[model samples]
Target: MTMSEPLDPNVARAAKLDTATLSDALDKLGIAGQCYRIKPRDVNFRMTGRAWTLLYGPAGKPCGTVGDYIDDVPPGSIVVLDNGGRDNATVWGDILTEIAHRRGIAGTLIDGVCRDTALCRQLGYPIFSKDHWMRTGKDRVQVEATGVPVNIGDARVAPGDIVRGDADGVLVIPKEHESAVLDTAEAIEVAEEAIRNAVRGGMRLDEARKQFKYHQLQTRQEG
Candidate 1:
């Protein structure tokens, strides 16, 4: 699909697929989309949307503001922050969480930390990050760039990439491969479900898996 094409339909389809399935799909495609070391604040919280990336770096002679870009983020867009995986300082807080939730933003994913867990939990705003700390990133770090490629938990995220997060953590799907990944994930889900059904119908677990070729579901396919 072209860059100008609407991604909402693919994003919607991806929203139904869990991180596990997506991860498997990525593996089958030999893609590194899994964001390791990043996890949701609350296990029950889940979110999916196109990424709006922000990169953070050490502050220069002058410091920069934190979370001033929230207002610019469109509804249903996921705010992805690349904070260099710094757990000592936080780039997100109660104010940002409150605004994002009120604005109907999908969620926030950070490579570093976020503060104000209480507000995010109360608002049911999903945040996947390395961890949470009370220290502010105001003077420690500054916004280096926005809408540029950034690394989050070892995963490279680009503007408009499909981001999915859940209790299992977060995964980034490259926009160019979104369609293929979603199609593969859906097919895997269907096969697994069939295996489950077969087992429930008195088939042995091993037999059901063999019948469904479960072992080959996630095996990398040669182009």
Candidate 2:
């Protein structure tokens, strides 16, 4: 199917995870499925708090720009927008980042380009997007609706799903699957840490890996 094909972004299921546990989960999951943060934004806006999900469109002309969602987002929620991969136009800018941060929004994940990198950097906002651009999304695009399904890489994200991002990248733990995945991922992380200690203490790679069975840990078990 095309990336922009119609899809329902709904909280068909609810997922929950605490901040302290999620860190452990990500550690075990390792760098995966996320957009591999090539270059970081300097904006001082940070996605404070633990885990908050923002469900959106998979493409199909999602309504509202990055700014429009800022007002509606609750504290600690992420602003995930779908702009189809039109890397030529920029959908997010400095003003939106500032507003989102003040509103206590966690961060933003854009399927398109962003503008005002230096401003974003200064504001300390964490943005995961396709590219950075100097152009504004004026006539280029506009939101057709809010709270819809948007394609973020290989996954489908909806409102209330757990979206976790970091220096590695971003991962969407479906609302239905988040709790189980988080639990499994935590155990995997602990085992990996044990392996890390083994390596640091002078054990051989194969020996340490075999002792931990690192290759066998599955963080996300598709149900």
Candidate 3:
């Protein structure tokens, strides 16, 4: 079977939680999932789904296409492009954005950069990346591989990994530990909510935090 599995219910469950909560859960589980430096192109953009990874490298004698593999991405899957953090060239742009939006792809996450910000913003297509640039990747980069493991920011993302992004940033959840991560995140969310409610009810902030053991919420737990 391919590394990418059928969409998991955990994807749905993850959508309900923000990246901060999920990041904390990953910390508690000792999983390095926070995709540092990867930010949403638009503050309002958000997405959660399985990763469909692509790896890119310096262009060869005969440069390959930048986005041909996008057509194969399944609906509801996020396109993860690893461009080695090159900010000089863009691997994604208007055409790819239009196609992905129309195809029902969840979103695009790039380790490097993208272009055509206006189109992406206009279509409400979610894209998280290091940044956006006008220079094209056409002759600067080539598709090195697809459906393989890739690195986004500093986090490793394998095909089928759960990716969640929002205004805060992106976080990758390893498929093998998705359940544990989600469970921990939900508990953290509940505890945080309770603390908030207690504070709203006139309880001292310190007392609420002490009551919920909030300081230890994201502490690594050893088995």
Candidate 4:
């Protein structure tokens, strides 16, 4: 099945690469402006997660949870939280992490603050947050619309967007581009490995670079 169609959780989890591989893939692909992840990091785990975004309002009728929209949400759903761009209230907490872990969830993303930060880290669940705090959001805010388009920092996420997060922040891979990104990422990884090996074998940087034409190769449109 294509990425635009429903993806198997089993397949997604299998597609998850280690942090080293992911970083190397990013480096090869020349994707930048990401890193400096949240504190008390766990570098061991990697997540292959999908977005279930939500907008929010205070005690309103149109609210839900990381679990509500994703209760039966596939095991790899990332639960990307977008509380109307507010970074003050808690959108993720210990219980949420516990729930996610139980359900085989890949991870969580808060484009805002999260409470029980220590618990999340303790469980070794990957959560990308804009900030951390102890404030409760149950009274102040609740989800307004679930599985809708929401903005996380500069990235716009829909229900099925692949949200990959590790010790190096999150990369929003649109559902439309999942196959392209994944395939290109692997290709980049292959080229990067070749370059690294050449560099170690007494080949100078400039000569190897000119010989490989890596820059031109990655930029060329693939049919």
Q: After superposition, how far is residue 132 of candidate 2 from its true place, in Å?
A: 0.8
Candidate 4 Cα outliers beyond 4 Å, as residue runs: 1-45, 58-72, 217-223
Residue 144 of model 3 has an lDDT of: 88
lDDT of 3 by residue, 101-176 (tens): 9888989999999999999999989999999989998889999899999999999999999999999999999999
Compared with the true structure, model 2 gives a TM-score of: 0.72
- lDDT for each candidate structure: 0.91, 0.58, 0.93, 0.64
Error of 2 at 126 (Å): 0.9
lDDT of 1 by residue, 1-223 (tens): 4322234789879888999999999999988999998999999999988999999999887677664899999888899999999999999999999889888888999999999999999989999999999999988999988999999988999999999999999999999999899999999999999999999899999999999999998999899
**Candidates' RMSD to native:** 3.5, 8.7, 3.3, 5.2
**Which candidate's lDDT is highest?**
3
**C-alpha TM-scores of all predictions:** 0.95, 0.72, 0.96, 0.76
Better of 3 and 4 by lDDT: 3
Return the candidate ranking by lDDT, descending. Answer: 3, 1, 4, 2
Question: Per-residue CA lDDT of candidate 4, range 157-221, in tens?
Answer: 78887666665556666666556556666666676678878999999987777777667544635
Count of steric clashes across candidates, in order: 0, 28, 0, 1
lDDT tens per residue, model 2, 1-223: 2211112222111122332345445444552333333223532322322233333323334434433556666666667766666677777888887887676566778777788877667666678777798888765676655666556664566676666555444666666655555666666668778998999999998899889987766443333
Instruction: Please report how far candidate 2 places residue 25 from its true position, in Å.
Output: 7.9
